[model samples]
Each structure stands twice: as structure tokens, then as C-alpha cells.
Target: MSTTPSDASRPSLIRWPERLGYGVGDTACCLFWAIVSSYLNLFYTDVFGLAPAALAWLLLITRIWDAAFDPVVGMIADRTSTRWGKFRPWILWSIVPFMVAEIALFTTPHLGPTGKLVYAYITYSVVMLIYSAINVPYGALLGVITDDSAERTTLASYRFIGAFVGNFIVQGILLYLVQALGRGNNRLGYTLAVTILACGSGLLLFYVFLSTNERIQPPQAENSVRRDLRDLLGNRPWLVLFAMGAISLVYLTLRQVASVYYVTYYMGDRGLIPAFLLAGTAFSILGAMLAPWMARRVGCKKRTFILLTLWAAACNAATALAGPRDLVLIFGTQMLGSMPLAAIFPLMGSMFADTADYGELKFGRRATGLIFAGSTFSQKTGGAIGAAIVNLVLSSVGYVANAKQSASVLGGLRHLMGTLPAAGGLLVAGLALFYEIDTKREREIGAAIAARVRSVAAGRPSDS
Candidate 1:
């Protein structure tokens, strides 16, 4: 176990620049992911001409690989001790391979069904696993950055800002890039868009590596991997977080997959997709900025639950009510729906850090990496399930490749894009009800734990 300093002696503030840089890197990575998540299914079904079910299965199987790989990456990151810091080294080394794999995944050659599935499986699986190596550690690094609750919230806000920027770059710019590069060849457009994504992603990774420093150090503990896994599984708060994350995955995945279809098919205006996305992104940013204030005033759990539920209901109802002529209303509802998402994502990161602290207090070792890895694994699994559901639903609605869909199909697609996600969002909000860790409770726990650590280090014993 690592020795602890007294709470009174802890730093009052975290450096803002470091936090911003971290967010920048996170934004870049997420931008690339958003591109993949938002457009890849469409590309596969329409451009690559692969079966929707096949694509779904491929995504599902790759996620199994991601789940299997997460813990291993976490363990490796925890044990790693390079001059660059445990997490930073992974971030540093992963840049090239991550970019390369992303490019390859998007640039796969036109092939027959089996060949296309094989190409998708090999490239996507590799990209996911490699990305995990970097992402697990990066996620874990959030807890190590600061122990101050206020500072952590600030950091999370900046992080979400980066995420929003990344979303903007990908969803906003990449669409235009594809059109420019495709020049009538849709496949070429995807390939060029991915190339641009790779460059942006690489630059962001470099910025993160150059700008951030790891101020907090992990405690040296003598547990084997087996024991670490056991300790992680024993954490109740973290278990709840994982469940919540799964629900978030379902919500985000559905929204991403639906965006292209909603604008292209339903609205009959593919160009409007970027505008709708930007509106949603702007709303999400506003919501995230307000979240910390809301949490402090009403309590994080309560505010989260209420906001998410309302957002979900509004989103679903808007889709149900809007007709083709009511595109304005539909976009308005989407912007409204984004409010909770922006608030929720950043809060979720902070909550995971809180869970890490709780786990440390109970187990006497800091297993930040493992705890975050579990969260990441759950998220990836949920994404996989979401992808599967989207594919299956589209297929069931009689969607055909490179052809106009029937009215029934379009109706069903709208429902999946709108109501289904709203329901998933509500389900996640309901899960938030089970969370027992309020902001007040968390502060108390932090103080008690810090005092206990201080006493123990001073060769005295204290009951927390």
C-alpha cells in the first residue's frame, strides 16, 4: 500500500493546462471513434454491400475481444513504470498503430460478402484491441490527476469540452470531407475522410503526450493479477457504475447509428445531418457546463436521474409526433435530447473516479486502472449490443442495400432512432436511482478516508 498525505496538506488546485490537454487528446480519440460508430454501419451496408446481420455479428464478436483484452491492458498499465509514467507511455506508443489501424479499417477494399465480413472482422478487431491498450490507461489517469472534488469536476468539464470538439470535428467536418474526396465514389470518400481523421487524431495524441504530466503516483502494492481482479469484482459502487455505463453505451450507440439514417432517409436531406449534429453538440456542451452546478445544488444522483428521464421522454415523444413535413420539430427535439447526454457523460467520468476512491478505502490499495477498465469493458460490451440491435432492427424492417426503403421500414427506422434510444436513456436514468453515493456522502467519505490514511502513515490507527 502507498502512504497517504494528510488532507490539509493536499494540493488546493490542479493545473488547468494539463486538464485541457488531456481533454484535447480525449476529444481527438473520441472523434475518430465517433466517425467509426456513426458511419461505419452505413458504409458497410451501403458502400461495402455487406449484410447488416453480418456486420452486427462482426461487431459483437470484436467486442468480446475488447472485453477479454481490457483487464489485461489494465494490469499491464498498472505494472508499467516508464519515465513517461505508466499511462502516458501507452498513449505515446499507441498513436501510430491506432492511426494505421483506423485508416485500414475504413479503407478496406470492395469484396464479396464473406470477404467483406472477413476484412471487417480482422481490421476492426485489431483496431479495437489496440485502442483499448491506450484508452484503459487514459481513462484510469483521470483519478490520478486530482483528489479534490471541485478540481475533478473542473477537469471533467474540460474533458467533455474536448469530447464535444472532437464530435464537432468528426460529425461536422468529416461529412463534408467524404463528399469532397468521394467525388462520386462513396468508397473513396470514406477512405479520404478516414485519412483526415487519422491525421487529426495523431496530432491530438501528440499534443496530449507533450502537454500533460502525471502529478499523482499509483501506490506500490504487492497483489498479483488474480487478487487485483478479485478486489475489483468486490467493489459494489463500481458494480453499479458498470451497470450504468452499460446503459449509457446503449443510448450513445443508438444515437450515433441513427443520426445518418434519420437525416438521409427520413428528412430526405443528407446535408442537414451536420447541422442537426452540431445543434445537438452545442446543447450537450451547455448541459455539461451546467451539470457541476446542478450536482452541487441538487446532488449529482438526483439531478442526473431527473434530467436524463426528461430528456429521454422528450426525445421519444418528438419522434412519435413529427412527420416528414415537421423536420424542424424533429431537429428541435434532438437538440433538447442532447442536454442530458452532455451532462451525463462528464458526470459519469467523475462518478467512476469516486468509485475508485471507494474501492481504495475498502481494499487498502488503489486499483484505479482495474476499476476503470471494468467501466470501459462494460461500455464496449453495451456498444456491441447496441450495434447488434440496430442491425437486427433494420433488417427486420425490410431495409435493402442501395435502395429506397418502404414506408414501414422508414417508420420502424424512425422509431429505433428516436423512441428506442429514449427508452434506453430512461432505463439508464432509472439505474441511477440505485446509486447511494451522493456528493455530500462522497465528500464525507473522502475526508474520512484521507484522515484514516494519514493516521496509518503516522504509525497511529484510526477507525474510518
Candidate 2:
């Protein structure tokens, strides 16, 4: 098994239009996710009249379900083969069911508390499973797209840009659209929001299906699910990265859910929620835009560690210091802190691909699906933990559902929103400190691998 490619090896860089198309689809999917993550709790507590503890249980259980299924889905994807390629077929197959599940999640039927809980469970579980189906493969597709390290970074940038745009649309514009659509009826408004999100998600999936091409066509490794899992566990770097992913998921989930309470209760300007979210998202886009250039200079892992540390410190300080009167300071801090997060996504994706390569090199089996599944599992688990924490914190602080809170209660909510997430961010940065891969090292590995592949193809004996 050679690692390097010959001089005549086909170039792996994707065309720009294809990249843009993939970006659009990814953005749309993220838009739906952002809406769900940012607003679902609010919708349940305020709109659906579900108690926080009850909602927490529902979320927790569903996430547990999701966590259980993620690895299985990964194993399935690894074993999958089709004319369209392993990943794309999953993406294509998931479109309709994914849309239906998403719409179901947001549909606010006039149901009793028991009915609502049932609905939440059924819809959330289905959506999560379908989401895992598409998302795992979608993430794994990055490795399949190209073997060129720099180009992979470029693709990651485009992907992050798409994610930023999706976040912007969901957090920045979706609420306003809901208001416009429903006017006076909150239920009708949210329903409209769900419809728009579902349609957008479907459209984006179609775009991804049409635009992107899989280049690194490794023959599907014929392995049992147990063997694939064992192979993934054997990859030390991949295991480390999976640990990092868990930390990141916690940080991201806290950030997403807390921001809503911070704006609504602490800052006393529920209207500014969109502005606050947009500011951070916009900064994230800027950060992603700068990643390629920065990675080339300082290497992806080191740059990520440095920036995330700075972000953690700034965010924590901002949370601890900001009061109701200090709106500008609070918002400014969040925006500045979010920039580093933007840079992290693409770099993280590149690292996962690198781990995929390392796995192939060491194990002589490509378990891209399994690797990507670890990422999905971490993120979902994080979201689950965050949801549980948010609910527990709110309940502990005497957060009464759908009622005006006392000043002290509001202050407590603010702290949970700001300080807790800041702390999580700090933990995430510390965890990332152990990431040892650097761009120079990655390039060297890529070059060596390419050379080995080339030698083998040329019928010359080569050492790899």
C-alpha cells in the first residue's frame, strides 16, 4: 500500500463553482440547525408552555437516542457503496425525510403538555437520526474531495463561509420573518418559520447533490461494523481529535442556547437578539476568511490554539463584567470573541481529514464514515449536555416559565448565559492545547504520501 501520488497524478482541487454550490447547501442546512438550536428552547418554554425540567428531559432523552445511533450510522455509511459515491447517496436520500422531520419539529400543533412531549420526542428523534445520516457523510466527504492539503483548507474555508451565512440567515433574519408571517399569532409565525427553514434546507441539499464531485475514489473497504469501530479506536490521533470535538461541542451548545436567555432576560432587549447573534456570526465569517492565509503562515493547529485561548479569555471577561447597563461592552466582547470560533471550524475539518489520512496510513483501511461519526457524536452529546445544563441552571435560579422574572433571577440568568459559556470556552481552548499537528508537518506528510503513490503507479518499488 503506497501513500504518494506520481507526477502525473490527477489534481484534486475542486472547481470554484462546485465549492460555492456546496457552500450554499451547507449554509442552508446550518440555517435550519441554527434556528433549532437557538430558538427551540424558547419556543418550548414560552410558546408551547412546556416546563423547563420537562423540556430538558425530552431533549436529554432524544440526544441519548441520537448518540446511540451516530456510530451505527457511521458504520452503515462506511459499508455503503453506490454509483453516486458513499457520502452523496446518503445526502440525496436524506433530503425528503430530513425536510419532513425539520418541519415536524417546528410545527406547533394545539396539543396538551403530554401530547407536546410526545410530539417533541417523535420529531426530534427522527430529525436527529436523519440529520446524522446526511451530516456524517457530508463531513466525511471532505476527505474524499481532495488529497491536496492546501486545497482541503480552501474547501474548509468555503464550508465555514457557508456555515456562517446559514447562521446569519437563521439568527439574523428568521425571527423577523416569523414575526412578519404570523403578525399576531405566535403559533402561526413559528409555523411559517419552520416552513421556510424546511424549504431552504431541501433546496440546499439539491445544490450539494448537483455541484460537488468525489475525487479520492478509494474502493470501499469490506469490513464488518465491529472491525470498522475497532479500526477507528486504533487511530490514536483520531481519538485525540474526537476528545477535542467533545470539548468543542460543549462550548458551542452552551454558546448557542445561552445567548437567547442573555438577550431576553439579562440585556433586557429581546429585540436585539438578532443583532447580537449577527454581530458574532459576521465576525466568525471574517475569521474564516482569514484562516487560509493564517494557516499557511502559522499552521492550522497552532493558530487554532492561540486564537481559541484569546477568545476564551475575552469572552469570560466580557461575561463577568457586563451588566444590564453595559450593552455595548457586552455585545462588543461577544463579537470579538466569536471571530476565533469562526477560524476553528475549517481548521478542525482539515484536522479530521488529516486524521483520516493517518488512519489509512496506519490501518490500511479507510474508515472516513467512522471518523466523521465520532465528530457527530461529540457535537450531539455536547448539545445534549448544554441543553440539560441550561435547563437545570434555569430551574435552580427560579426561572419561571413564560413569566416576567425578578431582577435577581434575571441577573442569575445572565450569569448562566455569559459566565458559564465563557468558562466552557476557556476549557475548550485548554483542551485544544494538546493538538500537535501543524501545517508544515501536514504538508510534509502529504508530499511523502503523494510521492509514494506516484512511485507505485510507475511500477517502481518504493518505501513509504
Candidate 3:
């Protein structure tokens, strides 16, 4: 629990297995994550048979809860002092609850639409709540696990690569699995898939809890909620990341929801869904793998993020130009686009760790849990809005479930896939331009924070 001089003064080398486990933890989280992000829209509309407009209302209403709760959960996690550490205990607490909530969320009751809507509201809210419990802490782990800048980036890469593995498992094979396992009862198929994935997620998260440690402790004197909020709001680097996190999820959620409709309606092939999502997941993995190397090649993570996000934006926009049935053009453009979007996940994560340090050095408070909670806040707030917009647009364009889509609906899918997400990516690029923490500030902050922590532990004045 106490900091050693070496732990405070230098970058601690995270072992390969620990890094791998940290990554695996995210992979586990993504099993649930990808399920909600990729399939929940389709499941709610097609399988559960909810009307588009109704589902839009559901998403919009529930997002309010998501936006509000993440920071509270983060604050709780930050204040929690445990022998297991500040963040890891939440992972342990969440495993069983997460399993139950996820299964309940995906389950379809035989109630009427009104009753079912109520069921959805309660279950969906529970799932998102538990997800924040595990995830906000896990994300905060990145800042605490190691303060080394390069190691944070590497860990983030591992984290997201693991995330896409979960993404690939669900996105790539869930449809086929549903088809095979459902045997014409698609609802049962979904239930079965969630059950299997949920069990696996619990086990992997247990491993994450046992394997990881919260090494970089927060500063000793952070107690005021008002001051914490003020510091978080005032931190400029954090402000930029907060915006980027929101836009990034907007980009991701819109594209993910649109991809299904694009294949099912636009291409007239429901069968291609798995492969298309698989391709995107594969490219996402590749992008995550190359993120660290790409950052190194460009000699700066910030520049790499800007360049790659712009590239991804261009690729998404190009998809609009392709003919609906042109598989080659569609796949090629998306795969190209997915790589950069994927690349930015790690970049954004590492940059967040930087913000934690910068906020601490600048504001004299280390709200790692609260700061990282903003990442989840942005994700849920942004993702929920994006999902709502897509559904509402589908309704506005006269989308009908299980029937032939109108030309207006088909065209809307293209714009959702292309224009909206491209615009989100471009916004990410533009926001990165305003980010002020470069390598120079990273070192200064890391050093200053290290000295500050070291001095506190030694009961002396901080050289920082």
C-alpha cells in the first residue's frame, strides 16, 4: 500500500503476463461491451420486435442515467481504500452482478409492449450501472498500474487489442452462432450467446483482479467533492480528452448500428453481416497492434492520433461513394477506415493517463477515478445519443421491421454509415489539434508528480 522510492521515481516495468492479463481484462469487459454496442440495437429492434421510435425513446431516456451515474461510481471507487487497492475491488464486486444484469437485459419477457418496455428500462439500466462499476475502475487502472508514458501506451494497445478480440468473438461469430444455435428461434439463440459470454467474462475478470495491482496511488489529500469537480472541469488537457471520448463513441456507435442496416437493407443480404463486422473487427485489431509502433514512427502520439483519425474520417466518407452492392469497395474502404479508428483507442487511453498526471500537477488533486469516469461518461452519453439518433432517423424515414425498406431508409443508412461517422472522426481530429500535452509536458508532469508522491510518503516538502 505504501510507495517505495523506485515505484515513485521511475517507470516500473510491467511484466508481459501482467500486461497480457490487463489486456485480457479489457477483452473480457468487451464481451459484454461489444454485445451492447453492436448487437443491442439489432436485438432490440429485430429480435425483441421493439418499434424504432420506441427504442429511440428508450435509448435517449436511459442515457441520462448513464451520463449522471458514471462520475458517482468513479468517485466512490476513488474514495474506496482497500487492501486489494482502490480500483480492483470494484472488479470483484461486479463480476456476479454483471453476469446477472447482462443476462436479464438480453432476455425477452412475454409481456405486452408496455410491460416489456418497463422490463427493458429496469434491466438495461442495471446492466449499464454494473458495467460502469467494473469498467470505470479498470480504465482507471491504466493510470495507476504504471506511470511510464510508453508503458501506458503499450498497455492501452494490449487493452484494446484484447477488446477487439471480444469484439471479433461477438461481432464475427454471434450472428452465425445465433443462426445455428437459435435454429429459427433467434431469441433463444441470443439468450444462449449471452449466457456463454457472460460466464467467460466473469472468469477473465477474476483473473484481472488477481493479477493486477494499483501501483501509482493517488495523492494523499483529496477529499473535497466540490474541489474535485472544479479541478476536473478546469483541467484543459482533460477537457479535450472528455470531448474526444464523446465524439469517438459517437463515431463508433453510429457506424456499428448503421453497418447492420447497410448489409440487411442496402445490400439485400442479411448473411453478410457477420463477415462485414468480422472484417471491421480484424482491422480494428490490426490498428490496435500498430498503434504503439505507429506512434513511435511518427515520433509523437498526438500527431499519430490526428493523422490516423483524419485518415479514418476520409475512409468513412468514401464508403458513401460506393454502390450499395459493391462488396469490394465497401469492404476495402471500411477495413481501411477501421484501422485508424482502432488505432486511436490506445492513443486516447494513453493521452488520458497523461491528463491524470497533468491535472494532478496543475490542480493539486488526483481524481484518477473521477477523471477516468469521464471516459465512460462520454462513451455512454455519446453512444446513447448516437443510437437514439440512428433509430429515430430510421423511424423518421419510415423504416419497417422485417419488411422491405424504402429508398429513403436505404439512403439514410448510407449517410449514417458515411457522413455522420466521418463527421465524428473529423471532429476527433480537430479536437486533437487543441490537445496541449506533448512529450515534454508528459515528462515534466511525470517527474513532478513522482517527486510529489515521494515527498509525501517520506513526510517531507515536495521538490515538485
Best-performing candidate as measured by lDDT = 3
lDDT of 3 by residue, 1-464 (tens): 12467775557769999998899998999899888888888899998988999999998888869778989988999999989999999999999999999988988999999998999999998888888899999999998898788999999999999999999998876777777888999899898879889999999999999989788766667598898889999999888888988888887889887788889999899888888889988999999999999999998888999999899999989998877778898999879999998999899999988888888888777888998898889878888888998998999999988889999999999999988888888888888889998877777777777677777877998755
TM-score of 3: 0.97
Q: Residue 460 lDDT in model 1? A: 90
Off by over 4 Å in 3: 1-3, 454-459
Name the regions of candidate 2 deviating beyond 4 angstroms. 1-11, 219-222, 455-464
When sorted by lDDT, best at the front, the candidate numbers are 3, 1, 2
Better of 1 and 3 by TM-score: 3
- Taken over the whole model, the C-alpha lDDT of each candidate is 0.78, 0.77, 0.88
> What's the true lDDT of residue 382 in model 2?
79
Could you tell me how far off, in angstroms, the CA of residue 329 lies in candidate 1 after the best superposition? Answer: 1.7
Candidate 2 structure quality by residue, lDDT tens digits, 1-464:
12234322655557899888767766867967888788888988888788888888888889978977888887788677788877888889999999888878888878888998888888888998898888888888787877777777788889889989899888877788779998977878888888887888888888898788776755235667777778888877677777767767676677788778878877777888999999989998998887788777765665655676566567756766777779778878778877777787787887888887777666657777788888778778878988877877787778886567887677666666567767776776666667656767676666666665666678886576
Output the worst ten-in-a-row residue range by lDDT, candidate 1. 1-10
Q: For each candidate, what TM-score against the reference?
A: 0.95, 0.93, 0.97
